[model samples]
Target: MQNSTCHLQPSLATSVALPVIYSLLFPAGSFGNILAAWIFLKQAPTKRTQYIYLGNLVAANLCVCSTMPFLAVYFARGYQWTYVSTECKITNHLGTLNMHVSMYVTIIILCSTAINQYATLKKTSDTQYSQAINENFYRCVLKKFRQPKFAKQLSTIIWLTVLCITVIAIIYNAKEEIEKDSKCYSIGAEANETTAGIAAFVGTACFFLSFTTVLLSYYCLTKHLSKIQKTTCIGEKHLIYSTVKRNILVIQMILTVCFLPYHIFRPIFYVLLTDRYCLRLNYLVEIKNFLTCLAAAKSSLDPIIILMLDKTFKKSLYGLFTKSTPENHQCKADIFTEETSKM
Candidate 1:
């Protein structure tokens, strides 16, 4: 006879573990995201094209974090949800929507940054091939595509597309009945095999697409930087190289730590569950849950990443946190002046 404890152990561990994790995540994520939003709003005048995408990213993370407390409550009660079915469906839908939005927006920002860097490097270099390309190409392609207005338009399009898909998901999930004492779970009850499989496939596809784009962007940027290092003076090379490298490092860190693990495991778990192979693969299920938690942690980590990477955001955040004085106020003005000069 199979031991019932063996059958129940994973659920027991999940029920005990996730609530504790979510509890810590909720406050931390909330504070970080709120601060990010506030800083971005205050500094919107000085914002560049990437900052628009980043602001949207912050909003997406904030939306995701807002739902975490409810998730913690659901997990804390041994996966049983006393909330209405509508609430459960909305929470689940919002989570999915924001995940996609965050990944896509990050990819957009990386691509934009890569293109700008490449253009700058090519223009400054003495390479014959780069100069052979006419001004028309630069004006029609790079300049047109990389404009700040285009980024705002792209942001609008992304939100609209996400909203359309989320509405579809919400409607699809709403058809199912939630039993009176049902557990508000992601897999077994809320989503059945077909829905879960579709979700996993979509998630896997998005992950690959975004991951490939980001990888290629960073590769090209690195290659360009290497060429620049060889050609440019050492004094000028260090500052530019360090800045690009830091940005690339932060992007790669977010992808590896938050997004990669979840996408890798999510599809496997769903396919196994759909085929009724999950009984023998309980360990993978636990791993998938852990990855999901990591994905959620991205909301908290993103604000810190912004502060680390953006001088303006860091200065603004520092000003907000520290005591105000004439010297500090003057320092802030100086930073703003320096940033404007760069633009």
Candidate 2:
């Protein structure tokens, strides 16, 4: 009986676990992203392109963080959630929308960083890199993509689209079986709908497409790094090569840890969510729920990642917590200088 049918009974995962996890993640994400925002916003003049990407990333994380308290409220209710309320639907819609936006935007920004690395390594000289920036129409478009204006414009478009979608979902939401089960986030009988299925399919497709592009870039970057390693004449610039390689690898690792599991299982979970899949496979829904939480947890982890990945940001963030003293400042400078020389 246990082998043939998985238990659908309530457990700590839905009732107690999610809220607890959300509680832990909320403060971490808030503190980290807030620091990140201050850092990026202040440095816009010097590093406009990086600021645009990372600033948006911080905004996306904050969006997720804002939704967590409400979601934690819902999940904490647990077995009591027999019927969905208007508030439930609204919370569900807001959480779902923010999660997807965060995922998609992070995917693009991280991939762009990798793609830029490939572009950087492709140019044999500083002259080539500078000349390559506006060499032709396509390059011009790519160049525009890296600018602050384009990021602002695109961010506006994404939020506007999300506003439209949220309205549609709220107005048109029908009570499907899964929603009746108080499982607001899962893809179930709704998957049978052409419109919903198409949306799900498109999202899954986009993730894999972006994943492939990043993987290809990572491979090419590795080859370039290897070539750089074989030459001893690069001198101090070898640190740049090492940093680039580390960043690319860390980006891939972050994607795998934060985003991969949910994406990998989403399609299968989508099918299992339908009316045809039966209650026996209901356990998969719990698995999917945990993965969803993990995806959301990326926001909480982003600040720590930012601290590790960007030294200037790390120093600035650390400064916020420490006493501001000239001797301490000199000590930090000396420490950084020593680390840089060692590297």
Candidate 3:
């Protein structure tokens, strides 16, 4: 099976559309991630460890975006990869790595934030049940893991673990034989049914895990916030409540827009392709390709989300673009610094 070749031809419309989409995404994603990186770097020293994870997320997005031009050219050339086999392998590997990294990192950020918020709320609760066994259990669990240092360590561990698993997959795929006449265009062509099946299984697991984590985190957060609102006067903490709500909403939007479609479609696409059912459903291939491109576009879209949701980032961006007096610039910088410090 590893010696066999799989020739999957994308539809003409899809072939044309993919390159155009990739072409547009390349510059937009690159610019946004670069700007995000610059902002994160400037604020890194004063920022919490959450910013460390965010900085890593921006870096991963940049890595994903960097491969877009090559993909564009590949699709533009009628699904033919003009590059050497090694380059083809590297490009494919990078895409897979970035996909997993981006999804998992986003999960980590959301889960950590949810946990911290829950811990903070619980610690300040005046309810009689605050001293109950369940409350103590949560306090103990959260106390063990809820710290900036722990977040930093977890981020490092996630990066290393993802790198290791992806590297193994890359090596396995690289060992597969390629036909001399075939272009390195179809990812399914690089591996056999067994490998593709395993990949599909892993992807399915990841999708469920990520989706469930995000959903539960947001649900718990919303529930907790509702309780707080019921107990406390809305006018007293309106700014903080609104800001937190906006951030959560932005996260849900990002998860829905950028990640959800790909996660939902990818496993099905892979299963069909591996089982040879996709030949009868050629449109699925096109949809899969479109989802792949869309997933990559998420990295680009994230910075825009951050800019819209984060006042500090928005202010810094505005100050950068607009001509301002040194005094005004200094004031904005101070504000930015203060905001990041609180983050």
The top-ranked prediction according to lDDT is: 2
Which candidate comes out best when scored by TM-score? 3
* TM-score versus the correct structure, for each prediction: 0.80, 0.79, 0.82
Output the better candidate (2/3) by lDDT. 2
Candidate 1, 219-293: lDDT as tens digits: 866787777677866475466556755676667667777888788777666556544344555566567667777
For every candidate, C-alpha RMSD to the true structure in Å: 4.5, 5.4, 3.8
lDDT of 2 by residue, 57-156 (tens): 7887898898788767767753354336565565566655556655676676676666555554444323346666666665565455555577667667
Query: How many residue pairs of model 1 clash at the backbone?
Result: 0
* lDDT (C-alpha) at residue 161 in model 1: 73
Q: After superposition, how far is residue 342 of candidate 1 from its true place, in Å?
A: 3.0
What local distance difference test score does each model get? 0.63, 0.65, 0.64
Candidate 1 runs further than 4 Å off: 1-10, 81-87, 90-145, 177-183, 274-278, 322-334, 340-343
Q: Which of the predicted structures, 1 or 3, would earn the higher TM-score when compared with the native?
A: 3
Cα misplacement distance, residue 261 of candidate 1 (Å) = 1.2
Shift of residue 110 alpha carbon in model 3, Å: 5.2
Rank the models by TM-score, top first: 3, 1, 2
